[model samples]
Each structure stands twice: as structure tokens, then as C-alpha cells.
Target: MGSNIVFSANNNEEVMVLPVVPEIEVNKPQNNEQFETLNNGTINLIGDEGLRTFSIASIFPSQKYSWLKHGSVAEPFKYVDFFNKWRAKKVPLRVVTSRPDGREWFNMPCVIDSFTFKQLRNGDIEYTLDMAEYRFIGGV
Candidate 1:
């Protein structure tokens, strides 16, 4: 399947200037399981039910755009503000990934665990977001 992915704010109307992240990486959710070893050398399953979690990483590249009217480099700053708002409010994010086989996976109810920003020598800004899925929203 194709590896193209897209990320969008769940509450887009509330956020007028969302960060433009061109490249994204999504790790599928996994089940949480526990096991206990019995005295008789038997393994007992314990508490296999809980929330499934996943992670997503995206990169924001630096470039000149005419949309800003003037050659502007404010994209990174805008992203910083965007991420900070989401982090402070503790909101859920939605992610959609497309496979090469014409299938798509929709992962939702994701909470931001961490946000990272890096500045390169060429003035390119890279942002990576680590997130965890709080609940399974199912995939199509």
C-alpha cells in the first residue's frame, strides 16, 4: 500500500491556521496485555483489556510561499503556537493513512504525548509529534 498519510485537527473550525505537515508517519494501535506466572510453571493471562495506543510523527519543511504575500518564514512559529494550544487543551487528533492497495486506516481519539521542533542549517524547520491513542476509532 502507498505510505501517504494526512493529519487534520478534529476541531478545524476552532483552529484557523493549522500547521502544514507534509510528511507523516503513523504507527498502528496495539493491545495492552498482562500475564502472570503461576507457581506450577503455568502462565496465567491477566488484565488484557485496556486502551490501545499509537504514535504519529510529522515533518514540516521550510519553504517560501506566495500565500503570505511576502516571502515569509513564520510557518514554524505558527506551528509552535498550534502545537502548544493543542497540548495545553489536551485535545484529540485524527489521522488518515492511505495504503497502496487502495485501503485507508483511520485512527482517532489520539492524544499528544510530545512535540519536538528542530531547526536546520538551511532554515528548514522539522516538527515531530508523538501521540498515543486513547481509544480505538476503527479503520475503514
Candidate 2:
């Protein structure tokens, strides 16, 4: 099986396959609350679920190596450029995680909450990306 993680903003016209499988951190907290009732009893309420967030910390390679998981090799700067342009556009980017046979486990449109990267001495770009699920607003 090849890489199962992919990122795209161009409707799959183009995509970037993660060079390695990152240990993703998934979080979606509930807003449960408790309040005091007039009768001196506590009332517990189960609030709506918060947006699910996905965190990824990995390295974008500058050169192809033995462990490279993706099929093609791209300069690290290209990855950075993609993120910069997408964030500037303020549009939801899509991440699709699926099985080798194409059974998807995660397919979400998310806003880029944060993106940070550092160039290491070896020319690899180490990056931390945080994305939050986007909830659609009313449509005309």
C-alpha cells in the first residue's frame, strides 16, 4: 500500500501525497456544562460537539530518500508555497485519508488554523500543521 494521506485545494486537479505517514492527533471536545437549578439541584446539559481538529507534525523532504513514501519527489519549498497560497486564499482545503483500496476513513474540508515550519540543517522542512473542521454557513 502507498501513502494514504493526501492534501489538495484544487479539487484533486493536483494533490500532495504525504512523504510519510504522520502520527496524526485528532481532537473534538464536547462542551458539556452544569448549572444550578432554582430548586438547588444541579442541571447537567450535553452541549453540541466542538469542531474536530487535526494536527500533523512532519518533515517535507528536500530530496528523495530510501524511506520516501510518496511516488514523486518535490522540493520542500513547493510544499511551503502551497500552504502559503492556500492560507492566503482563506478557503477550505481537503484532506483525505483512505485505505489502499480507497475506503476512506477521513475526508474533511478544513480551514488552516495554523501552519509553522523550520528549515533544518539538512534542508528538510519540519512543519507543524493544525487544521479545524469547517462548518458551512447558510447558502443562497
Each model's lDDT comes to 0.54, 0.83
Give the alpha carbon lDDT tens digit for every residue of 48-132 in model 2.
Answer: 9999998999998988888877554548888888888888988678898876666887888788889999999999999999999
Error of 1 at 113 (Å): 0.8
For residues 1-140, what per-residue lDDT tens digits would candidate 1 score against the true structure? 24444445655543422224244444543444555566655554544455545544444445665433222234566666666786687666665555546477554556778888888776656666676666635652
Which candidate tops lDDT? Answer: 2
Q: After superposition, how far is residue 126 of candidate 1 from its true place, in Å?
A: 2.2
Model 2 reaches what TM-score against the true structure?
Answer: 0.86
